[model samples]
Target: TPLPTSSPRSSPNILITGTPGTGKTTAAGMVADAAGLELVTVGDLIKQRNLHDGYNEEFDTYWLNEDKVVDEMEEMMAGGGMCIDFHTCGFFPERWFDLVVVLRAGTQQVYDRLKSRGYKQNKIEENLDCEIMQVVADEARESYKAEIIMELTSNTIEDMEDNVEKIVAFVNGFRSSHK
Candidate 1:
């Protein structure tokens, strides 16, 4: 594999996180494309990892055997330059990450998106509070040693692309400054 930056670069990793409707997947995809980095989503990976046995929905809060997926990510981290996407940043050691981008969408926007996705009232409240209180942002701050940035989305495809571009710029600047 071609190294992420041949300019005597330091390793870098990012966590693209937020509530369900906050565009974590979309932002990670676009940011990875823009930055020419690998985009890895822990939840999807975990789901696939557990597909053979198929986990119940309740396990998502804190997967019973999360270490299995985290172990894989730890191995992947050795190669560096990865954009890790997940609503909750529970697995892997915090030192592996370089930055945390907490994507946010307004209450009405999130309610609309989740409603269309068929989320029930209780689930909706959980996510709505996650956004209102900036839970992901707080989580990242609590877990990682790196700086965190917030990007607000309007629940539009264009907003995802735009914010991803902005994150790419931020990462580029971060890499440059650290050099």
Candidate 2:
């Protein structure tokens, strides 16, 4: 393989994926705010759809393709760099990116957060199960090259920021050496 360059040859689409109420949104927002990146939430897409919000019973929520979201983000790159944030990195096209960070949350911790946000019990439980089962991570691993999928645990706000920093440093390091 070619030696890593000093910076990203092109902008990278970074996905911060995790279960609901695991601070994916918050962490994504913070990263975007701190780094001037684009924040895209799949939940927001479902909410915007203003149509069907029902899950496929045993499966996790699905509103749209994270890759399409990344595509939209690509449009907003402003000819420089940007971060695209979401909860499911599964559908993302691996070759399109240099990195994919998967955030994880414990069931109880996740339940509490979702409950506090007024999520229904079944919805909360389903989401928690998705996290516990590592569905998102699995999908990401399968879709992307192993090197691109990163697993992170986020139990608190600090965890989210720490995860963000880890990803940021990774990106920065990647940039420092990549063409």
Candidate 3:
């Protein structure tokens, strides 16, 4: 699908997703602050709300209940002005978000960052492979309209700052257009 040249909606519901250790959470926080949107970190949501069906010992990850997440988020998404932050967002219904940002980083950088978090070797490798293969970007594109799906590189501070500025501009433009 062709990408739209203009912002998609006023007070848009946004999704910020990427491979692990790719600076998605940090960038999402910045975007939410700059855009005056509420941030929802899915991992935290799963833990706080116990929204998962079970835990996986091998990956040290939860088997999230997709329905529970949708049930919890549908109302907030309908109201708009929400930034959903998570590594896995493709499963979310397309109607829920107006924009989706897929953050990416160099494989080496992702490896180091995950390492700093003390992630298991297998997990770190998995993330590195995902980044290398652009899994996050692919997922976003498949789930959302091309115009609503943006790919941003966040391997450096400057890149992150630029991404935040771009998202803020998009939000402001959307608001203005609606007005």
Tens-place lDDT digits, model 1, residues 11-119: 4677788888877887788788889779888777776667224544642343446567777677777656789988877455866766677788889888988889887
Please report, in order, the local distance difference test score of every candidate based on alpha carbons.
Answer: 0.71, 0.66, 0.85
Best-to-worst order by TM-score is 3, 1, 2
Error of 1 at 128 (Å): 1.5
> Per-residue alpha-carbon lDDT of model 2 for 48-145, expressed as tens digits?
64423355554444545444555555545444355656666665555445667777888888888988988777888788889889888888888877
Better of 2 and 3 by TM-score: 3
Worst 10 residues of 3 by lDDT: 1-10
Candidate 1 error regions (>4 Å): 1-11, 51-54, 57-64, 146-162, 174-179
lDDT of 2: 0.66
Worst 10 residues of 2 by lDDT: 1-10
Please write out the lDDT profile of model 3 over residues 42-125, one tens digit for every residue. Answer: 999999999998898888999989999989888878877899999987789988777788888998889889999999999999
In model 3, the number of clashes is: 0
- What TM value does model 2 have? 0.76
Which scores higher on TM-score, 1 or 3? 3
> Which stretches of model 2 miss by more than 4 angstroms?
1-9, 45-80
